[model samples]
Target: MTMDTAIARPELLLVADAVAREKQIDREEVLEAMEQAIQKAGRAKYGHEKDIRATIDRKTGDVRLSRWTEAVETVENEETQIPIHIARKFKPDIEVGGHLVDPLPPIDFGRIAAQTAKQVIVQRVREYERKRQYDEYKDRVGEIITGVVKRTEYGNLMVDLGRSEALLRRDETIPRENLHNGDRVRAFIYDVREEPRGPQIFLSRTHPGFLAKLFAQEVPEIYEGIIEIKAVARDPGSRAKMAVISRDSSIDPVGACVGMRGSRVQAVVAELQGEKIDIIPWSPNPATFVVNALAPAEVSKVVLDEEAGKVEVVVPDTQLSLAIGRRGQNVRLASQLTRWDIDILTEAEESERRQEEFRRRSGLFVEALDVDDVIAGLLVTEGFEGVEDLAATPVEELAAIEGFDEGIAAELQRRAEVALERKATELEDKRRALGVADDLAGLEGLSPAMLVALGEKGVKTLDDLADLASDELIEIVGADAMDEDAANAIIMAARAHWFEGEEDAG
Candidate 1:
């Protein structure tokens, strides 16, 4: 090639513009990459250790190759640096810490030099493309996208998402939804992560947000911010429940989501392969919300245990199966939507349980307090559960019960306290015989009776108590004896001795 042809190739600028437009990156970056590739090829022609640099004009694509050297006070390397005495001959005013540029002849494209340039260009372009993919998709997480199934490996589907490929793992697909190559699919962008191989975009059709997004597209109220999706739970292709509330009192959120004649909901259902959707109105009160979630089956009563995070729902006998759904799906979705554990039962079952609990508490009161059946029944009806509650109650509160005078209340309390004291004395004797450590009794949360119970359960030492987890402690004692928090506190107190030993060792 002639020197003029080698120096400035205008066609190179056209190639750079096309590559930049196709790769969706800056044209300046592609020009820089091309300069580096040409510089490497130039280095292969010249000495590799020399600082050979190449530059391309942005406007004209004029290429220039040069070798750079620093003018130092002391002569170091003869190839790149020159002494000031020698540099002054060329510049006539050379100074230390200044750079000198020496022009080099244009490289003749040998086979190996051309191959090296091609490799550098390809590598740099691929890096830029991967980075572009990462930057573009990172902020698009939680968005819904459409794609075509490119191929399947095992059960994973590689989808062509226009700009890049995305992964739809087998477990993230809707259940029993058989997708083939070239099939169009819509999925939610759950995650965008950069891996060693490349930027991975993970899509999911079974994500609960997928249903919410579909609703947002179909329901104008949701898109307009008049209605909000409170929560969503999906059993994927079988059934799904969504809770929605309206910011405006004038609009019915559930009705708006259902659309006119169920057109909006039907659209979502068609996309989900006929997954049943229940649009329920959201309520701040968990009990009311749970009642709404277990719809199509009437709830007769809902008893909530807030501390335990459980709700008991009572339905009619005929509606039990419907309330629980096929294979317990309805109740499971209700529990997830309400963020509470649900126990469903028929009205008859609840009534029978109530009677059994009444009889059990009545029998215990009668035997422990030496009271008659009528007095025991009265105490149980007044909602007193145990001897401890009776003994702890004030005389006035006890007398407030129907058919009980102040004198009878005082007598009942005295008897309850005496029985409890005798029981404590006997338990103390047993605790001593079991070799329970005395330090465990000093724990703040443990009462004398609770300590005795722990002794019986073989939690003898402080280490023993500390070694047991909170759940294990709660199990050793009755569920009503303590909550998980109190159990954790007691165990921590027992573990304090370990910290003291650690400090001593330190």
Candidate 2:
């Protein structure tokens, strides 16, 4: 057929336009998809080994098919590249890196060729649609999105969010939340990822962020930025805790969130299937924040060990169970909200533990320094927890203590040194008996006790110590005994030999 007959196929352009409008994609991409489909059909008709290509006129919908090869100095691939010498025969001015095109006859839409073209067009269009969906929803992550449950496959719910499908994994759903097809759901778009099948949007109804967004929706103060949700923790369908702070000093953030007659928080609670919510006022002080987080349970005292990131909360005997909650849910959510490891103790338990510690320290001092109970009691009362601290105390510091004369201080110091020496000798014997290496024992940060502990755990050699991660070492030694940075330093010291060996080999 002539160009006039081919141009008569204006229905081709109409199809591209209709598909672009239906798919809500760019018309140019649709045209490109059509061009690719035609090129594929051309390749099927001709030899597949040839570098066949196709193009469609944007306005006229005229389809052109051709075979192209790159002009190169040396043709490595014979089918797709031509030697510069041969390329110059067609165009004398042809140069390397230039393309040479040979037009092919217009393709007749045979049954198989037309089917293959349709498949190519459909596949390419679907790919573009997937990419569009991914781009559209990727930015919506962490925002609240509403969708309808399309279906459930193996406990995973596929939700239709208008343009794309989102996955609500089994674990991400609120506990005890049941849904069937066509159930409307609101969730937090936690993640959007591209996969082999398509763009996968991961939604979560149980995420703490979901609760926060719900509060923002129900409370105008939060949405308007007058109140800020500092942190949220959820038991998901059971209970949740949210900490809020107000930018305006005159505004009460907790009250604003609760609203008049509890209307604001009630809406969020209803959406969460009647999950109890504690709207605590956030504080700049971690202790005060933790105290507020553990509301409905009075806290008498909070002893914070910042180094260990743990808080000891003491409550009255009656409030102990309330503070701990049934199965410890209250304190667990409080810990999550405050970002601290909380240990709840009743007043009686705390007092008993204090007395026990007092006796333990007094006994330790008496045994180590050969002092009387009265003197040891005085040392213990002076805030000495261990003999190591007593021994490390400067003479001036000891003399400053009440009833500690210079001579008494000097005697205490001498006794402390002697006791430590004796303990070290015993630890050294224990370490040797356990076959702990001398090099590991000699490491600066590894005390005699730590060396003995390592030996007991089968980490005797420097190499063995080097093999342990910081967390593993912290596990072996208690968190209070060593922190991540100190443990990492010790591990790096243990690894020094490896580098030395490398230098020696070099």
Candidate 3:
């Protein structure tokens, strides 16, 4: 032991006490920090600061700094050693070669040693803070975080998320809402991920998957794995469609996501800034899927065209608006939900489409024809709802209606003359549309062109129209003109067509 070891001992302990009192930490932490820092400083100085030794007592929380050397047979280096007999003077139990603990006298640390201590302390603190940050966010993934909007830089949203700021990109922001500095809002934490800039917080408003994620948070069944969200399709704020399957079967997936009385869905909708959500059941069958997709709007029939990724859903004429939604949102979402192109129509539109189809199918109207709505409606009002009706009916009979006139009769005659041709043309168009093939097979799709072809072929009589064989017609008229398909289409269109004369007379 040496007198120099005693000098600095009191001062080192005093620093430890002072730091503990100021930082309100356990005394051992401050002493341990000092011991580590002083050792690092001594290492940096090489032999220059050989007397600077530091120790922290684990039991008493005491800190001490001193200089000493072992009593070795021979001193390898003077900086860390002492003569063997010199170490034995401090203790009777100490042999000549045994180590001795010596105290260093109080002395001002040089500029370099002080700087080294400071660097080590700073590095330790930084490492501690790093671990603290990692622990803080690691458990916060997939949770909602409330943050105040900080600033906007080139449409990028900067939000102060308590301990750190999160960057919400332009695409992640809600479509109609603009974030201003100091706006308070909540966002879902898509992920807590390490990035070059540190933890990157991803926010989303338009993501289709976001809907399901949101429900999983709010719905107990979903969180417990009782309900599974099958798929989601969104139009951002205005509309979104989702498909859900109940794992339990007993628990309703749609109702569960929608909440008891909509409280659950309202929470999600509020977070989405008023986005509309339709929770529909998922079906493996294409027909069933199409029906499910047109939610909040009842579907009577679903005609599938799976090969073309298309489907036609039929609804009553009155539900036309609801089925299509505002600017066709319902059908659009349905298309997104079912992954199929959907064509929507009112009964009237379907009827009009049927007429076009029949014209093609019946070999009636060939091309370049537009039927005015008024005439069509008039004919529709008069039981001549389709071209096939006019094709089989006598021109004079159609003229017998209230607005009857020779000119009107001739017009009816012309229309009926082209019925089958129009129907056949319409059917071909519908066929290319890749919807249901049978959708055009109904008798209501007749065109006037078919009627003319029929009259020319001596099939104008009512008895003839009734007895017409579509297959025989196809054989006689050639596949390109009037094939069996054309004959059958003509008969179907005429039967399906509403005769204005008959309807008016009735």
Candidate 4:
């Protein structure tokens, strides 16, 4: 058929005027559809997010198109083609090996899908516009936004973020923070994405930074840089600790955050529904910093291990229990803020930890414990099956064995001492590390056989008993068969090692 026949028959467009009569959409949109349809039929395929332009006659709804290319010497394929002579018509200067794109319209556009494709092209354009909007917002994730609560659906809150709806997940809600219809809520937009529905923006109030940003919004000193938030830790809806500092000596960071008569903080607290806010002054000195972090608790001394990033906080015997907190929460948060391992204890426990460190760092472990790793090699020649069996034989008895020499025997004795001490120390240290408090005294009172039995059960040190309360001791030692006082006596005896022996002697 000729080009005129194809134009009269039309493609999926049905008729040039059908757009004005039926789809009720602007005539421009229908023209865009026809242009896109003709462009797609010329290529005979749908192209994705690409930059191919098309022009449709506003009057006839017929279209033409082209893609950008440079004039090239060798034409690998045929889509965008230009003879070297004809290419100079568009460009005054053109090269043979360069690129060129020549405009072309389908001679028989109606030969492709006629009416059906016109409808599909319009739908594709609508879908593309939706995606365009989504792409514009997807990169704007993790921004704080103000949005009205449009409504709640399937437990997910849909917020109208002006041009888009952002999803506020159920878990991200500040605990007990409710929303009313049309209530304008301020939230941190945690994420944005493209989905079938549209742009998906995830908001969060439980996020700790949300509190910091909220304060920044409400406090001018912070926004303007007179005051800055150094650290923020939060248990949303319950309490938060924020450390602030001031660049200007005249401005008090804490006072600025707290505002006059607690007014500034009260506004944030009210937004959080009476959640407590502690505005602390930031400190450069780590020990001072930590004492501040463990607020409400009196710290006697703060010993920090700089290389290992560990802190040992010594409190008075009276404050030890409180400094450590319920389930050790106070020290735990302090550890997170300071980015260090924190050991919280009474003054007495601090002294013992130092003593334990001395024992572990002593030369006994270096030369002495070196023998443990290769004990298997020595045993192969000497006929001992395992470490415990070799240990059961005294140093002198092992010295008498065929392959053993005096120096090797002596080294073995030292290894045993360090190994046994370390094993006991580790058992004790593990308990202390678990946020359990123990007495500074050692364990004793148990009979020698019972002591040996306890070693077999891995209760090698007094700290082990400290980690376990009286009930745990009973549970392990089988109080089932023992009389009540006997079980209680055994428990007391187990803890007697670290204490000094009684004054009177036989």
Candidate 5:
């Protein structure tokens, strides 16, 4: 429509209504945009320094343009403000903060003015649309959305989500899954970001959440919350593992997810481009859950190191390849699903390792306590890990061992204490040789062995220890030596002198 027709005719409101409907924005916003466009043109017709404003009659579509000059005690600019004495001539009751408004006749728009107005309206509408898109989709993150592929740029898919467009980056798409323009696709809304250019909606097909959402859509029990998907891990387009639990005991989680003849799972697999899925039962027990995660392979034994957050799984030799999968894919996905680091070993390998450990610990007891092989083997078999364990054991408890008498237990304890003292003395000598400070040795949590370890790492003084972070201290010593809290305590103790000096200075 021409600018004159747009401003003067009743068709302006109709055009605004149509634009609002088409752009999916509020009708009032379109009217405001039109008002801004008119205001821009009004300033061009009048002086640019004048305070011009424009408003549309929402009901009649009539446009009003006016210059607003504030009634001030003293005029700052002749173009935009008037003195109260002069303003009183136009409005007898005008207040100091009130405006003296003068209505202006509509201007005949030239080609350039019309283009500038159009540009303003277009820019305003785009900004509103972007804001609306951001507000609508920001809360929809982690939801499954379907859209048609609008175009591709640099291997990234620009998807048209009806009212808004979303981006599916190349890495987010399943490997080798080809999508073309105008093709319909489903993806998970991973993020919605407000960027300088516009609101960015990021989509992903390979996200583990995508797989979980797909399963929720396909599985009736999961949708109704009878069965909950605990975790999901994906090697997109190749394989995935989902751990599920059922609140209703009668309904089997794995069997329900699989469906009759695998219909339910097949639907999700089809959407994922034939990625094989293993639906495993979830358990509260970490060992049980880990065993369930490694499906199609029997776990002979599981040794968990809770402090280390690692699990060693012993499987029969025949099940090793299956448990590990091709190129470790099965175990890798299992690890992701369980949130644990897994070390897999064959039955024979685990047996050999256990035997070797038994020999080593037996030899340690034999040498440290000056005991015979039989006695050392008994000590190792009874779970005495070190000379410290022997020294710390009560005489009554030590005598309670099958082969031990009270006299033998007492002698063993004395010998254990002597061995620990000798080890400490050796470590103290090493610590002194490495120049670790005496005050550092006085720290409560640190043993002489740890002091030597710190000295070897060049943390030889209170200042050096104070400067070390807890993680660095843990690393310098050993994870088994102390945990984060103990490390922090020692570091704080090392820093005590600094506070004392500050107090003295004060």
Candidate 6:
């Protein structure tokens, strides 16, 4: 190409404008890329070791090339740096560390140099496009976006999302859902990450947020913030459960999400390829929420074990199959929606288990308190769980039980205290036999029974207990004995020696 075409090429500005418009990127970015390409070609024409630079005038599209050398007190490199005395001789007011620039004649583009310049421009433009895509999509995470399927690779779909392409991985697609090139699809933008190859925009059709977003689009009440989605659980293409709450008491959240004749939910289900959805009203009461989550099956009773994050649901005998769903889908989804572990039982099974527990506790009272079956049964019926409960109860409270007076209540409390003392002595003997340390036994949260249990598990030293995580300690001592917070405190207490050693050494 001629020097005038290469130097004052107004066509270069037109090309940058066209590329910037097509890529949906800033025109300034395109100009910067073009300058880099010209600078690379200039460096190839000049010596590679010299610092060659190029710039394009924004208004006229006039390209200028120059060589730069730094004036340093010591000449470190022959090509890029010059001695301060020589630099000052050329530019009379030059200071050390300042750069000196020399204008050069425009380069005549050879075939290889033209090809190299094109590659550099293309690569820079691609990098700018990638950055633009990342910046645009990163904050759009958790939103639902529509795109056309561009192609597929190894069961993954590459979707053209207007200006950028996103990958819907095989596992992120709803099971058995099919898409072909040019097919319109809607998915959730779950993540955007910059990777080695390029910025990756990850889309998911099976994400629970996708279902929630669909409801928001279809239900005006939800979109306007009158109704809110609390939680969602999906088996993806099979079934899903969503919990919703209404900020306005007059509007029913579930009814509003269902829309007129189920239009709203049906739209979401159709998009998910016939995935069945159950929309339930959410409650602040976890028990009520869990009962609602297990839809289509009537729950007779709900019991929560807060420490373990577990709930027990009792349904009638006929509702067992429906409550658990096919292969436990219903209960599993309910558990996930409520963030609880669910154990389902029939009414008959629950009643049988209650009777069995009554018998066991009554038998213990009878053996330990030397009471008759009638008296022991009465204690168990009155909610006295063990000898500890009986000993802890006030004599007046014990005497308040029907068919009991002050004399009987006093005798019972005395016997309960004796039994507890005997149990503690036995546990302490067992703890000693197991070589449990005295310091561990004296830990504030640990009881005699817990000490013996820990000793049996070989956690007999403070260091051993300190090494255990809160969950590990709970598992060894029994979750029913202490919750995670108490376990963590006990472990922290055990670790006190470690910090003490550090202080001494310091």
Output the worst ten-in-a-row residue range by lDDT, candidate 2.
1-10
Compose the digit string of candidate 4's lDDT tens values, residues 1-506: 22331233244345535753553344555566667665555455434332355666554545556564545555554444556666777776887765554454444536445554666676765665566557767776656789999999887788887756788887888788878779998888777677786567789887777888889988999989888888887777876778889999998888888889888899999888787887778899988988988887898997888966888888989987677766776677666666678888888887787667544444333443564434435553465543445566787877887677877877776666666676767655554444333332234344333344445556656666545555655656555434446655656665565454653432
lDDT of 5: 0.93
lDDT of 2 by residue, 256-340 (tens): 8899999988999899889999989999999999999999999999999997799999999999889999889999999999999
> Which pairs clash (backbone N, Cα, C closer than 3 Å) in model 1?
none
TM-score of candidate 3 versus the correct structure, residues matched by position: 0.48
Residue 10 CA error for candidate 6 (Å)?
A: 2.2
- Considering only N, C-alpha and C atoms within 3 Å, which residue pairs clash in candidate 5? none
- As a whole number from 0 to 100, the lDDT of residue 81 in candidate 1 is 87
- Best of the candidates, TM-score: 5
Tens-place lDDT per residue, model 1, 1-506, is: 43442376899899999999998888887888898999999888898889899999888888889899888889778777888878878887778978788778888778898888888988888888889899999999999999999999999999998879999999999989999999999999999999878899999999999999999998888999999999999999999999999999999998999989999999999999999999999999988999999998899999999989999999999999999999999999999998999999999999999999999999998888888989999999998989889999999999989999999999999999998999889888887888889998778888777777888888999999999999999988778989989999999999998899789989
Off by over 4 Å in 4: 1-34, 41-54, 57-142, 151-154, 180-183, 193-199, 351-506
Give the CA lDDT, 0 to 100, for residue 419 in model 3.
59
Query: TM-scores for all candidates?
Result: 0.90, 0.89, 0.48, 0.55, 0.93, 0.90
73: Cα error in model 5, Å: 5.1
Q: Each candidate: how many clashes? A: 0, 0, 68, 22, 0, 0
Model 3 Cα lDDT, one tens digit per residue, 1-506: 33433223466667667756654455666666677787766555445646457676654434456666666778887777777766666665776656676564444569987888877765654444344455677787666678898998899888887657777788877788877899986776666676544566666556676677778889989989888887788988887888889878677788888887899999999888899888889988888888888867888777777666778887988888999999878888888788889987667777788787555433322222245545555565575545666667776776777766768767766766665676677655644343322333234534434344444566544445566577755654455565455567666665543475788789
Consecutive 10-residue window with the lowest summed lDDT within model 1:
1-10
Q: What lDDT score is found at residue 225 in candidate 1?
A: 91
Candidate 6 regions exceeding 4 Å error are 1-6, 435-445, 458-473, 483-506
Judging by TM-score, tell me the better candidate of 5 and 6. 5
Superposed on all Cα atoms, the candidates' RMSDs to the truth, in angstroms, are 3.4, 3.2, 20.4, 18.6, 3.2, 3.2
The window of 10 residues in a row where model 5 has the poorest summed lDDT is: 1-10
**How much lDDT does candidate 1 score?**
0.91
Q: For model 1, how many clashes?
A: 0
